[model samples]
Target: MTVVQIRPARSADADAIAALILPIQQQEFGIPITREAQPDLADVQGFYQQGSGNFWVAEAGGAVVGSIGLRDIGGRQAALRKMFVAPAWRGAHHGVAQGLLDTLLQWAAAQAVAEVYLGTTAQFLAAHRFYEKNGFAMVDRAALPPAFPVMAVDSRFYRLRLG
Candidate 1:
């Protein structure tokens, strides 16, 4: 069995991260967003590796297979973003998604992040279930903290609190 290592993302992993996420977002999810639209992808270090926030990648066999990011939004809050796993690496057998989430949660707790917010489209039914199953509660948009970063494509929001 190939070992999957989850670690902090570096500038060198930028391309692999983009490669892993673009297809899942554009082709699989049919989201019409381009690379330019998401500038964060171009500078994961500058965007996510600051304050109490971070970005991580799941690497297996020397390739990036999954990724997740935490964006510190102040007030002990953070916005979870850019979570994606390769098609073959998904599900309980691989545990890529859950592993990424677990790492994020652990890091959040260490950072004293009181709340983690995420936004996704309703079309991602599996994602909604995954977040819900992981102690994230669905919340109305208006209920989100003002500092929360709401993406243009996001319609469904969820929040998870950590002590």
Candidate 2:
């Protein structure tokens, strides 16, 4: 298994991060979002910088293989976004996703965020299980925070409370 390093994303890592996520968003999950449509992939640092949030990237052999983001929605709450892992580095073996999440959560705790929320599509069954396993609780759409920035393709939502 390849060793992975999870760290805060830099401005230069935008393209590699976008390349890593587009395939999964298109072929795997069949999301309609395109690279041109999702401008955030081109500016990771700018997109996730709201309130007290930040973005993270997982790299293996200097290549970005996974990512996760925390978007602060004010009122001590934040929204989790762009959590993805490449197929070659998935499962417990690579630990890419977990590392990214652990890093984000560690930062979130330090930032004093009370809750972290996310919106995902119904087709992501594995993602749902993964989120649940990591302490995110499923909630109805109406329960989502007003500032959560709901995406057009999002059909499910989850929230996790931090200490």
Candidate 3:
């Protein structure tokens, strides 16, 4: 089994992060998104690692296999974004996704985040199940906080309240 390390992402991880997410978004899911659409991946420090927000990467064999980011939107709320796990590292056997999420939640709690909201495409059925199983509840678009960043392809939303 490969030992996966979950750690805070640095500016240097931009390329690796982009490499891990774009294919999952465009090819596997058929979302048709471009690298230009995800400008945050280009500036992890300025976009995600500022204020009370942060980004994390799961590394195995010195390569990023999974990523998750929290964007502090003020009012103690945050938008969870860019969560993706490479196909080879997914599932309970690898636990890349779970580890990334655990790290994000721990960091959010430490930063006093009151809620974490996420927007995903309706086509990502497995993702919807994973989020639901992890204490996130499905929410109508109208229920999303005004500050929550909704992506152009996002059609389903979920919210997880934290202390």
Decide which is better by TM-score, 1 or 2. 1
Window of ten residues with lowest summed lDDT in model 1:
29-38
Winning model by TM-score: 1
Per-model lDDT = 0.95, 0.90, 0.93
**Per-residue lDDT over 1-163 for candidate 3, one digit per residue giving the tens place of the 0 to 100 score:** 7799999998889999999999998889898888888789889889989888999999999999999999999999999999999999989888889999999999999999999999999899999999999999999999999988889999999999997
Q: Which is superior by lDDT, 1 or 3?
A: 1
Which number leads on lDDT?
1
Question: For model 1, how does the per-residue alpha-carbon lDDT over 4-112 read when each residue is reduced to its tens digit?
Answer: 9999999999889989989988999999988889999999989999999999999999999999999999999999999999999999999999999999999999999
Structure candidate 2, residue pairs in collision:
none
| Model 2: lowest-lDDT 10 consecutive positions | 42-51
Local error of candidate 3 at 6, Å? Answer: 0.4
What are the per-model C-alpha RMSD values against the true structure?
0.6, 1.1, 0.7
* Structural similarity to truth (TM-score) of each candidate: 0.98, 0.96, 0.98
Runs of candidate 1 with Cα error greater than 4 angstroms are none
Cα lDDT for residue 153, candidate 1: 96
